[model samples]
Target chain A: MKILITLLASIFLFSGFALAETPEQKGLAIAKEDDKRDNGFQDFTANMVMLLKNRQGEESTRHIRNKTLEVEGDGDKSISIFDRPRDVKGTALLNFTHKVGTDDQWLYLPALKRVKRISSANKSGSFMGSEFAYEDVTSQEVEKYSYKWIRDEDYDGEKCFVFERYPVYKNSGYTRQVVWLDQKEYKILKIEFYDRKNASLKTLTQSKFKQYLDKYWYPEEMYMKNHQTGKSTLLTWTNYKFKNGLKDKDFNKNSLKRAR
Target chain B: MPFIKPHRAGWTLLFFLAILALFRFPVKVFAHEISGFAAGEARLFPNEALFPGQNDQSASFALQPEYYHEFESGSSFTFVPFLRVDSGDQERTHFDIRELTYLWLQEDYELRVGVRKVFWGTTEILHLVDIINQNDQVENIDTEDKLGQPMVNVSFYRDWGTIDVFMMPFFRERTFQGTGGRLRFATPIDDDRVQYESSAEEWHTDWAMRYSHTFGDLDIGLSQFIGTNREPTLLNGTDSNGSAIKIPRYEQIKQTSIDASYVVGEWLWKLESLYRTGQGNENYFAWTGGFEYTFTGVFDSAMDFGVVGEWMYDTREERATNAFENDIATGLRLAVNDAASTEALFGWVQDLDTSARFLFLEASRRFGDNWLLTAELRAFIHQPMEDLFFDLRDDEIMQMELAYYF
Candidate 1:
């Protein structure tokens, strides 16, 4: 009887340990692995462009000659130049994003001979009439949201970890977003946006990942689509350079006029 | 249909906006798409007429199409093609192209040339009756009704604010009633008399400039407008008293305005003033100021309230009417979960000159990111007077609108 009792207890203990390893736990582990592959991007810069199509079937293409200076523990500096249409040729946008505070921005208009600061917190607005919102340009800081591990799944034949995250910032555009992370690298594969009503409004897909500096995985292109409007925005990033030692003064309003 | 000669400014505005659109696209790809809406309303409140032509109703529609392309060098281009139709008991429902334009935006400046909308005046809150332009009021009017002049304009942004300047060579729209026109009266002066004559100019140019800035806690702005209104003169010797009078019908007008605002925490205060000059200008000056507060209640709900006042002065040698008006308004806006919100506003406008009053109410709500609705009701009331111009007994109007944005 003693032997039988001991055997039964051992069996129960083993089963308990087996049940503790849930799909969520497995997904989290996979996500950590992917994060390792994608992490350690200290600083980088790129230029981007977008083409917008209106419901009237009219198309407008916007050119952004952009430069970014990022740091691992400090902040990021960004400058954007509008390069098409002779009237707007000298327009420049500059931003100094802090690691723990509000970002400062300045736009330089050649016609106005001045720079304008964007003070309003209306980040949900379309970016220059494009499908992308103003918030889309901001860097995705992991600590800005609360996340929950959902499950481990195979996406596009690659292992992925699905996570639901809620924005903690007051000025965020959406209530919640579900993100898919590559299991091999912490790179974000896709994201689904849910509006205030909890209805899915849009989806973003990232692809064509390239490893730079032997440590950072970068997506060369991204696409976002509005489910209801059938409108779409494609972002193509090119001419990337890393660790340029950008200074805070470079993002000042005075620099806007010379952004080009 | 009688065709009013196209205003030279209108043609220029269309061309400008079209060119802007052209440069935004890839040179090899040129695509054009058309889209707009048509709305018709037949009045049934007072009484319905048996026949459509006899009904006290109006119907209008608009078609706005856009064209675009991409260039081999990765540049962009765009053009907007527009048309309009309006019909009513009055036979003004003729077909016309309301807008056609091109636009181009580059790194430092944006150039918009063509026959397109050239908008000015930077005021966030305007009385429903004060804004003569429908495009400025997003919640009201069809797309074509909100259209503006054909001109070339550009905007430059800096750290403090934005500076926008434009040269409009053509502007085609209805002019305000003055000089004892039939439309100037509140009621029909004669059964068969129309309020306006088709007026068009060959080629004229106007200049406007706007500057907006933020300094510390204050937001400041200034705008200037100088232009000419070229109306067809009465046919060779047609006079106001029934004699034919031929005089230069075209007139020149100018306007200048200054505005400022201050915001601290939940409290916001703003002020604006405008002055006008020139012949046949019917010069008018106006100023307004207001403040508002917002707070969150239990359960993390939000509410806002505010009040404002305004004054206006009319200066015309012929009319010789000086009027001062003050308005007090309060609004309640509420939100839940910071996702959905509803707002209701009430206002009272007091006419110190005539000792009259106008009351108004407006409400708006957002169901989600895609859907929004708004409604407004206004009533003009006062003691009877011998002026015999404005029937201040019981004049009321209501408007409602629904919108979906993508």
Candidate 2:
């Protein structure tokens, strides 16, 4: 009787384990949870310095002021105004992203005294000649990619969940991207990009995260290295101020011309 | 005139004093800030001018300062003052209000009043729809520079598109190079002799309206203007020396313009066209269409190469003063995605009927912290005497400029 009872108990436990969720289901659940935790910030303004290095190790820096406003049921809106290099000073770029459709972008050229609408198909191109692409700097919506949880591993002395995501938008340069998120805070710590040919293209690492308002987690620095070319860009963010009461009107095309 | 007029030497002194005053102002004056740049340029003509008494070199300096103040309720004020001093040409040495406007922003509408500059059109070769401001001819021959226009503008934003209405109270005449300038005609243009078709002349009330929107990869705009024509027709006249010359005569006209651009991948296709009825029933049409293709990260390097081509046409052909009727323009742009933001562009425009060609090369880069250096070369070939640019055939020259910003 004891032997029969042991056999039945083992069968029941094994069946329960076999009915667990798949990798894709697990990844979708994780992404939803991450998005929920990051909501309700409303708006933010920050200053950033981008350092670019070439194959020869020559370096150049750019200073910019960044502002972002969260939109309900869509991606965030952002504006970046350049303040350095004299020649490009007062140049501004406005981005209006969407969850299911193509994004809208406009560039304000101070010299031309006009605002130019940029092509959304050029999202795969570099941003201001940096290693980061236009899509990389833009706010990534949950609907932008389909995710699949790869595995769990230890990264930087913290437990991390690794996932592979495929972009849903057309004309994207990358075929897939692998991201590492810490289990405790659900914050992204590293990402690897693959080109359209399924070749390794770039790696981005985030560090120096500081909690704001005791509820928001933002990385103070992000570094991106291009694997194809021996070039890299380091973005150091400072003066982060959240919940600035910025409204939808502040992110319109007219504001682009008025941006300092 | 109530405007200040300082002598050549006095202008330099006043410029420095203005800079000093700007620096002395306190930073905490309002909720916004002030910023600007100062630049000096020295131009040299490699060859002798076709006209007599023209100088081979000229020195010029410009100061532009901008100020902004924003209220908590979304109302804002902006002031931009511009001053330029040319040692060789008095007409180029002048000051104007580039922009001094107050803006009130609402949930879906905006209102602006004062002097402002507005630009329109998409094709790089020609800006046919951009007629809000008069040309500042003394600034450059490219037609990209403009004098500010005084007006009241109202804009309404909607999900479908944006509608803009403009009411201009005064008209501004186009500025031309003085007799002493190298690029001037054999006879000088007397500013006071300028003629106007309207009885109100410079004070004629003008109006314009524009509708613009974006649909997916396509952006389009349509606008109409009823006012004094920004482009003046040259009329027979005499200068102070009693020699025959051309006097600019502003005419009343109605113009309707349309501009559109389609972006696909790394390619951009643009078109700009306009129809105008004025100058004694001699109405005509003009259009420009072009495309640009860019190869990013060429040869696995941090560089981009862009090829551009455009065609310009006019119903009146050679009779057009722009001399671009029935012409083709081609250009190459190279960008070295370096930290200094270095770039170079080469363009050539050729008349299909006369084989006349105009070529230009421009390169610029930034250095140190707040300095920018630029160089340019211009040349003309096979220009016919009937063309407007015929007098500039011998003006092939190279130029270098250094600018500083604070």
DockQ, all candidates in order:
0.04, 0.51
Model 1: share of native contacts present? 0.00
- Encode model 2's per-residue lDDT on A201-245: one tens digit a residue: 999999999999898889999999999887999999999999998
The list of candidate 2 runs beyond 4 A from truth reads A1-25, A54-59, A168-171, A194-201, A227-230, A243-245, B1-30
Model 1 Cα lDDT, one tens digit per residue, B116-215: 4432322224421111121311112112244345667686766557787878765444322222211122321221222222243425567778876657
**Residue B58 Cα positional deviation in candidate 2, in Å, after optimal superposition:** 2.1
Kindly report the fnat of each predicted structure, to 2 decimals: 0.00, 0.47
Error of 2 at A33 (Å): 3.4
The numbered model that scores best in TM-score is: 2
**TM-score of each candidate structure, all chains considered together:** 0.53, 0.89
Interface RMSD of 1: 11.3
Docking class of 2: medium
Task: Provide the DockQ value for model 2.
Answer: 0.51
